[model samples]
Target: MGWPPASAAAAAAILCLGLLASAWAASAAAAAHGPRALAAVQPQPTTHGGLGPRSRHHRHAYAAMMYMGTPRDYEFYVAVRVMMRSLAKLGADADRVLIASADVPSDWVRAMREEDGMRVVIVENLRNPYEGNLGGMNRRFKLTLNKLYAWSLVDYERVVMIDSDNIFLHNTDELFQCGQFCAVFINPCYFHTGLFVLQPSMEVFKSMLHDLEIGRDNSDGADQGFLVGCFPDLLDKPLFHPPENGTKLNGTYRLPLGYQMDASYYYLKLHWHVPCGPNSVITFPSAPWFKPWYWWSWPILPLGLSWHKQRWDDLGYAAEIPVVLIELLMYIAIIAITRLARPQMTKLCYNRRPEKQGALVQGLIKLAAILAMVAAYTIPFFIIPCTVHPIIGWSLYLFGVLAFSSAVINAFLLPPLAVLTAWLGMVGMLFVMAYPWYHDGIARILVVVAYAFCSAPFLWASLVRVIDSLQTMLERDPYFPRLSEPAQETEFSKLF
Candidate 1:
């Protein structure tokens, strides 16, 4: 049966309300230790008189900028743009929104410029830094570093540099109150940069630029790596709180993952006891909140709202309107696909195409199986880490990804290959954990390999879904089978 609109609408409302309520209960329970006045998007404790009522009447919002430079489509960019626009509405100066890309469609550029006052910056001369290099993002990372240096001149104080996948839930003026030379947020668990709040000084920002230039060739291509290594001095701020558990404050050891910013949420929100007044301005990364987005992680909605909850509350029905629109668009897409495919289905019926019937059934079965797998995957995702020790759970998680991938390549069937891979990874992890901190021999390399195994699944699965989906689609389509390169035949896709 087709999903009913009213039902979908009700479900969305219930889901939203449940999530918000659950998150709020979680926050309120945590906050019971101490009460906090709702604050803007700054790094201050709420008990410190968040945003002075007087400042609300007189405060000027700082100009913040972010970009989407990835090869992925513009959905993440659009989400970030929406977030930036939300920032503008929060009783502050909403000027200078910039979206950068290498080859943005003119239509999109025109829409953003004419509508949102966003300038599109494009970098076309980008190339890999090493022609003979294998598995190195050094050149591109270096070029991006150079570009950040160029962006420093934009002259915005307390720049809240966020990923293009982030959303803003409040007035960002609170970030500027930070008088620090610079502010760097390490997810309570790992010192990494999915997001950062930078106090812009020609001196500080320029020094960071220099660091990026120097570390451009380092094996680690993270901008965070350059900042951590060169600056030596960093304003590590506590950007989140996980009050649900006794992890009073998460501490930063080395980044558990590579430059990648994913971390155990409960671990990431523990307080670092960094010295700062309750109302200090700061930055939060795109992880921790674990926004239920399909592409990159979503902004920490609670953090985003905690900082801008009032502005968001003020948004009223307006916020609901966009969500409703998105849902309606999805509904429209569903209807369109169903109607168009019906005609094709009718033709197949008249021709009595047995192969066509099998393909259609196979595609539907594959889709059903994929949905089931995704549901199963969600169980481990929510239950793990918070329940299991992060290091141990993360190891299991690393194992899970490879198992899932094997299933994908083998047409969604549960593969024996996955169980073997998991056992192998678990054994490898035990050996590595046994090593001394400064192991001498393959033992050290084994530790690194084990760590890599722990992170490999999510990293691999995120990147390979589209490729895997295309492979499945090609296999199911008789027309695609006749093509020379089955993977390249998505252009003939009749199934949306």
Candidate 2:
């Protein structure tokens, strides 16, 4: 009996080791077919656009954002203002341009136009087939179809696109001389979307749109993907060396890495010497815990203090304080409304007996199923000999157990919002895993796949409840409906 159990354990261990080995190999294999493949392409000159030092056409650098509303709205507004100021300080201020949706406030438009010297182009008529939150692997992305509109600005001979997060340290206007399409390598083989040069034309615009219509997929589900797809031959081009000693440009070239250094390099440089020094433009990529703007984020990144000062000096503390105060008030009001409405919504939507509607039981069942699936997937790994698997496998095994347990506990106790957050969090995790930077293979994919399928029912239920809760408030007047009476059941409620 002892021998049989030991043999079974040993068999399970072998199976898990094989799975892990395959996963590692799969991830490595995926890299070749992915962005790494794109990066590996050697730079080669294209026949489509002329490669010369000078063009008589006007060159413009553009920065754009979808100014929908709320707290982030002011942040980008300030960013554009500061970027313009930084450019002017460096004597590199070309004609500043902004691409915005129709919904942007008239006052903000006037500010950018009158105060900042920015030409605001409204993307009112532009329509894209894939313009929304694509909720699968691209859940974190908002359709960046708007960025493609820059190609429609025909007056400029070339447009160097800069993301709002980028901070220019010096005048790098020489970039205009690089090429028709130019960007620096970011991923192993792919270029970053943050900073790039494009020659604007109706032909390019139509071509991009056509590619979209034909269902061309971007690896990241954003503009970067489409651009990479459009210019598949980016890597082989000569690295863009800045024009030196009044020499004329030789050939099409990639922007040097110094043009778009990650702000994280700031930390590394402080502790140790690194190349790509005195970056031309430093970009602060997104992170949830901190940003270069927040006061708390300053200690680690004092260089951003100057950028903040520039914003204040350009916009004035008096002017800045009131705008921030108004934004804060707006945020508070939105939160207050949501808090006051939640109980009213719950009371109305669920027939005032949310607990009795099988929500808790269903959630519990789903949680249990997820936990069981995770356990089944993980238990075999523990049976493997102590040294067979990588430390990453052990770490992920622990993470799955903890994540499943938390979901189970929260499923019954917390509101649907918690469940929805959990589901979205898991989705976000999958995106992180899928990102080329993660450098993992089949094991991670298998773990995610197992968890996602097992948890799908719970995710669906949670989403339905959250949507129904919001819809209930939208349909009825809070005061007029009266607490004594509940609204009729929704079609969604019946299905859920």
Candidate 3:
């Protein structure tokens, strides 16, 4: 039997009360620790066992720009910080190297060299000789062409070049065992510039410069294209096999796909219910703003909120309760309003019975509703605390994209499990915010209130849908009644 609307509302209220009570308990537990306790709870950054005995001395290189004249200096600093942290966690015994133009700020160089414990290599004579096109538009490939300088680092026997936006999930120190010019086949039979192993030599570097001076047209107009042009036979190269038991190695090797899984796989695998086993690294090559360092970007991508938690730890920036409260309330309001309006919108968009109104009226209503939601949610971000508001707006924007895209695809209703997963994410975020160094006594109380006010109703509604869906599946009941059959007979027949 279906629940009455009044009963459902009451249940939601009870859930809210329960959440509030739990929040109070959590706050009390936190109070027991005293004022000085939060410092003890801040997670210590991972420290690497630098250069152990028998470890090969290979260097890892990252190419990035500071854009001196522009206002993107902070961008370079954060990227370098996250990359250095990831390297320190996984690149134990391996040398951390960065290649930047002379225009890069001295502060960035000092931070990487002294604070991050990386070797900063300054390339003063950097310039791009080749011009390339991006999406049929003419552009210079000079910035990308700088990656070629890694090959000129002949001081290192083997080098692993990675983009600054790439995050290491596991110790890829084992990639050094592979032969020269090893890379994964992720970008349409070509190697992704995110992570690749190469033997540094002056000869290869000089040859690449020669390719550039001669006006070699790399079809894609980037480093990846130039590299593909340089090695036309890379696709035909045999799979990489590491030398074992004193065996001799001869051919170029392809790195395992797990070493450089693209961010797209995170969502695709989840949609397919496929398990993404431990990856050696996860690369965010597209969209410079989508890097995981920013709290706003990572949550929209796949992977648990745990990834963001780890970043928060490294950053040591605890979001104020007001920030999280503002975020949670906005999300809850948006989700509740959207879900409530969906049925009417669906009927207006696709009515089984036609009305006198034309299609234009329906389209106009949808467009207005979308515009209203976007404005309502987006305007609040500007008012919230500057540091955390971007994350709040970003989260809402991504969900908005998902909702509208689903409508466009004619799959308006997400599966109950999918909705449940999203609800759980909201709940998990609140709890993460409750941890030490993240909240004060008053902030903790505010968190509890926010949880009760926002998460409770949303959770209750999602749970109702999930339970109803599961019960229907198990009972094998018809989801719709036949209009052709008599209503009295249909109701009476069920008694049999």
Winning candidate number (TM-score): 3
lDDT of 2 by residue, 1-496 (tens): 1112333443344335434543443343232212111112222223122222332233565656554523245455656767776776788636667786656666667878788877676654234445443555232345456677777777776677888778777788777766677887756788887888777787978787788778776666677777888778888887776566634354445777778877765553332222543368877755622455443243334444556666656765443233233323433443344344344333333232323435564455445545544553454333221211122223333343343333322222235353435545554554544344322344445655766777677667765664454344333332322244554566554543
Encode model 3's per-residue lDDT on 1-496: one tens digit a residue: 2323443454345335334533543353233211211111221222111112322344444333332332234444565666667667664557777775555656566767677777666554334554436543223234666677778666666778887666666676666666668777787778776778887777888788788888787867778888888877877787665556534344577776777777666543332222333366777666655556544553344332444455455653343344445445544544454555554433323222223333564355445434533443344333332223235545544554343333322212325343434435544764454354432345544665675677666656754664454333333333232234333446644753
Least accurate stretch of 10 residues (summed lDDT) in model 1?
A: 46-55
Model 2: lDDT to the true structure:
0.54
Error of 1 at 50 (Å): 35
The lDDT values for all models are 0.38, 0.54, 0.53
Stronger candidate by TM-score (1 vs 3): 3
Which model scores highest in lDDT? Answer: 2
| Per-model TM-score versus the true fold | 0.38, 0.51, 0.53
Q: Which residue runs of candidate 2 sit more than 4 Å off their true CA positions?
A: 1-58, 69-71, 125-140, 244-252, 271-278, 319-496
For each candidate, C-alpha RMSD in Å? 18.7, 20.3, 17.2
RMSD of 1: 18.7
